[model samples]
Target: MNLSDLRQDDLGLGIGLRTVHFGHILENWPDIDWFEILSENFMHTGGRPMYILDQVAERYPIVMHGVSMNIGSKDPLDLEYMQELKVLRNRCKARFVSDHICWTGVDGTNLHDLLPIPYTEEALKVMAEKVKQVQDILEAPLTLENPSTYLEFAHSEMSEPEFLRQLANETGCGFLMDVNNVFVCASNHGFDAKEYLRQVPWDQVLQFHLAGHSTFETHKLDTHDGPVCDEVWELYRLAHELSGGRSTLMEWDADIPDFDAVHGEALKAREYRQSMSSTSSSLEND
Candidate 1:
């Protein structure tokens, strides 16, 4: 896959459009490149969230990111949910629709968490087919984010990147590269983070997610509640250099501070991109 074949535009740095900052966003109209909406939040709503979204959609390029696609679930695809997602995508004119690579629940139960799937060939075929079905219904590529996993399935046949690479190849889907998750998973699972980044199919990367994670005695949790750590920032720098830059987003879902604070964190990615660009130019000249 050539890098130029990426579907979405390089939309610059943006933040997840949260209700906490709605007033500030509507009033100040801060200098942000785009906004990513949590798709389920607006799917069944006709209230203030939808109202704010309508207003924001008019001003910025919005992308729909969801947590409930459940692409890797054993159960069949959720048709009603897919229809609602289509409506929302059209309503907001979202550049693309995305969700986690893992399943959220099974057996008609909603777990409300991004649960990792085993990387076996059987699971791969199932997920790739489900992704294709989702794309067919939405009439667009379904970009998927890598999940922060706590444990690994011993029965897995392939590595994480290998599974994603083949899935993208089979379904022509896009990827939301979460650098923080990669770092957290690497630290937990004892793999080289840089090698994981190298294995990613960069051409299929549509967006970059940089968020803060909480470290416990055992493992790191993707809490998205604070500033991005320095190691994650370095991983973001590497991702920028690898993918030739993509639309970067900062997520602060929990304990989110004021609007300026979140946007300030998001702006750091812009600085990283600029620095990488300058260094690349200098190297080229040298």
Candidate 2:
């Protein structure tokens, strides 16, 4: 399948649609570009959550980011969940659907965590078939995000970017490149973060995820509980240039803050993009 067949578009700067800002959004109808909603939150709801979602969907562009697709599981694909996801997308008129590249569970038991997978030939083939199956079920390209891993498999064969690039080439799946995850994993695994960005399949990247992480004594964790740090922001600057710009979203899942603060943090992406444009103009004149 061709990259253009994915039908992904640049939606501009966005923020994750969290419950804390629902009332503010409903009342003010802020001038945000779009909102990325957790797909599972609305899939099984018929009460106030669904009502709030209906109102939000009418005003802003929605994209479904899920955590339960289990794309790499050994178990069979969950058809019932896939149907629910499709229905939610149709209801919200979501632009695209996304989930992590790692597996969530196996044997019909959900561990409720984004676990890492081995980057081997066998694993790659399994993921490719699962991605194609999901795309067919949803009738849209499935965008997968790179997870922040705490450990690496000893028997892994390739790097994360190489695996993702090959998967995209084989199955025509899009990617949600998380810049913070790159920085965190690089620190934990001792790889160069810039090199990781250089090897990504930029053509298949439909969006970028920017967030904050916490530093421990020995390693860093993907907390997403604070603002985007300078290091991660720098990586995002390079990613923005590499991808020629894409829809950027700020994720703050814990220690929740006010609506204005979260939205303001997301707006920092515009500053980074503008700086790149300014530098280019200066070089052209000189």
Candidate 3:
């Protein structure tokens, strides 16, 4: 699939639409570039949540991100879930739909976590076929995010970025590059975070996810609990330079703060973008 065939838009800076911020969003209609909604939240529901979503959709661009889709699982694809996803996408007119590169469940049971997949040629072939099937179902290009992993498969044949690059090359699916995930995985797995960014297929990256994580004695976690750390922001700056910028979103899912605080954290991306631009201009003048 041609890179240009993937439909993507630079939606500027955005934050995940959490329930805590609904009142502020509707009342003030804040100056956010866009809002990303968890696909499952509004999938089989109505009432206040759906109502607010409708209002938000009318005002701002919406993008659907899902924790399910379990694209790597051995279970057959869930046609019903994908249909609901398609319906919701049309209902809100979301720019595109995204999910993680990890599996969420197996054997009809949901683990309720983003489980890691082995980076191997066989997994790549299976994932590419599944991605193509999903895109066919949605009738739009599907974007997958890199998974933050604590452990690596001993039998794995390639790095995660290489696997993702091959997947996109084969399937025409875009990527939602989560910078925090890169940092977390790098810290836990002992890989160079910047090198991971360099290996990413930036041409297929449709959006970037920035979030905060927790540090533990053994490993770092993708908690999204607070503000982004300095290192992640530095990586994000490099990502913006590499991808020439894309629709960036701040994800704050746990210990959620007030809307203003979350939005404030998100706006930091603009500062980095400006810095990257200035550096590029200076280089050009040399």
Candidate 4:
């Protein structure tokens, strides 16, 4: 397959590559089309993670998803980290690099959390510039995610989708459109998720994230702890229909189940996508 033609996947489903499923994957090499790996997991000099990464890359296509890009922070770019990532991408033949839009740390301190940024013009500009620097260093555009936020900024200039579009315009980067993040944000901020999805530039979407979330009395949290809810599944179906079925990934990070359970959830997504495609084709035939 011409790699560029692979906007999503033939199977329309992907399992988040975890260590627990590595052996099963290596042994059988299941029918999974692709896998997304945490960029930090394989950043080390040498270890089991790196070895497995090499094996997987050789077997199936892999994309790099990271936590510590820290694109929105005021601090300078992490050149050292980027260099290591570039090497990893080269070694593993990663399809693309992606990270959350929030900042991870400041003042040379790693907070180990994807912290939200204020929705101000200055903040947007800072993030766009950082994305540009990262792309230039890596000699390719990066993918930024719409994070699940708990708070909103008092001095915000634009909506979250507007911020994402502007960031893409400035940096010429693609997007990793996380449907669960938008759902969590909407439940927390009381905005319409469909409007957010409509306003986004769907053509530039490189990946689609589907994961589970938890709801509290005050708001919902994008915790990929369990199966994706019906609401999230509905939104994901809409997104895939809109984006022409981009790369779809099922993320169940915490309380991860055995290999069979994860694979089953992914297969369910593929079924949903196929059902939608059939409906669309029927309409056209009429």
By TM-score, highest first, what's the ranking?
1, 3, 2, 4
Candidate 3 regions with alpha-carbon error over 4 angstroms: 1-8, 280-286
Name the regions of candidate 2 deviating beyond 4 angstroms. 5-8, 278-286
* Candidate 4, position 120, lDDT: 84
- Local error of candidate 1 at residue 268 (angstroms): 0.8
Off by over 4 Å in 4: 1-11
Q: What does candidate 2 score on TM?
A: 0.96
Put down candidate 4 lDDT per residue, 1-286, tens digits, no spaces.
2224435434356778898888888888898888989999888659888888888888888888999988889999899999999998888887778898899899999898989998788998898888878888877778888999999888888888888888877777888899999899998999999888999887668888888888889889888988988888888888888887777888989999988888888788887788888988998999
lDDT of 4 at 263: 80
TM-score per candidate, chains pooled: 0.96, 0.96, 0.96, 0.94
TM-score of 4: 0.94
Q: Model 1, which residues run further than 4 Å from truth?
A: 1-8, 283-286
- Model 3 lDDT per residue over 6-97, tens place: 43467889999999998898889999999999999999898899999999999999999999999998888889999999999999999879
Give per-residue lDDT, candidate 3, residue 199: 95
Residues 156-195 of candidate 2: C-alpha lDDT, one tens digit per residue = 9999999998998789999999999999999999999999
Q: What shift in Å separates residue 3 of candidate 4 from its native position after superposition?
A: 12
Local distance difference test values of all predictions, in order? 0.92, 0.91, 0.91, 0.84
What lDDT would candidate 3 get against the real structure? 0.91
